[model samples]
Target: MESLVLTIPQVRKIVLEAAGLARKAQFGIGIEAVYRIIDHLGFVQLDTNYVVERAHHHVMAARIPDYQTEWLAELCEDGSIFEYFTSASGFLPMHDFRFTLPIKKAFKAQRKPLTQAETNLMKQILDRAEREESLTVGDFENDRVEASSGWWDWRLRAS
Candidate 1:
């Protein structure tokens, strides 16, 4: 008798159903985590496979939404999918799934720009601070010379 083989879509459906159940149960199961479980069960193969094939299988079986598919695809394509694994543990793949949303907020919020007076004041303060402390790395000998010129130099040298 021929062994029953499930197509990638069918396998993905099963995995996705399992993941949904996990989510409903608040089990925190992710697609990669599910993939690890499936891989351990010998239901899915992810070794040395073509990137496209791996991505397609992941997309079909992982239940990832269309909005997040592009990022997942990119992760797979860029070979970063493996980085999500914690160890050589086969279950690492299932925990690697992530979803990101593009934020549309303004880069700079609607706020009044700095007034010319404020800018000038800031510049003046910065200039004063810079002038007050011009950092310089002096040699140990030079530091000793400067220190010796101070009133406490004799006492410090005696110590």
Candidate 2:
């Protein structure tokens, strides 16, 4: 096998093209455009931040000329995209949800064992999710839980 030498311009173009942030996205192509962009990008991080706009929106704006703040939300709400942790919490193509399973498994394995209270709370949340086909902390308003526990720490492994 022969090694092909690449020039600076060639590498730069490849990086930019993959990032999509520096490329011209399909203008007026609508939200389907975000699907395509994140497909190529692997995942787009969502941040609870605003410095002009949220990070995901800002990232999209750099690539997509006709981006809307609601577009990414719509993708997730409609299940066209699902949430995953890729370095940071991000939205990814729904078809790619399975790809995050390995990450979830690894994350689960390293988790500290659940306390009895935590275990019961998790069961209540899981049960509610199954019954309602949706869940939020509001569903568990009556159940006392530690206020400081991070949402990402939900997958408490049983001992």
Best by the lDDT measure: 2
TM-score of candidate 1 relative to the true fold: 0.19
What does candidate 2's lDDT look like per residue over 29-121, in tens digits? 578888888877778888875667778888777777777878877988998898887678888889998878998899899999989998997
Worst 10 residues of 1 by lDDT: 99-108
Clashes of 2: 0
Q: Rate the local accuracy (lDDT) of all candidates.
A: 0.43, 0.76
Off by over 4 Å in 1: 1-16, 21-45, 50-52, 55-62, 67-159
- How accurate locally is residue 19 in candidate 2, as Cα lDDT from 0 to 100? 75
Instruction: Give per-residue lDDT, candidate 2, residue 101.
Output: 91
The true-structure Cα RMSD of candidate 1 reads 20.9
Alpha-carbon lDDT of model 2 = 0.76
Instruction: Output the worst ten-in-a-row residue range by lDDT, candidate 2.
Output: 135-144
Candidate RMSDs in order: 20.9, 7.4
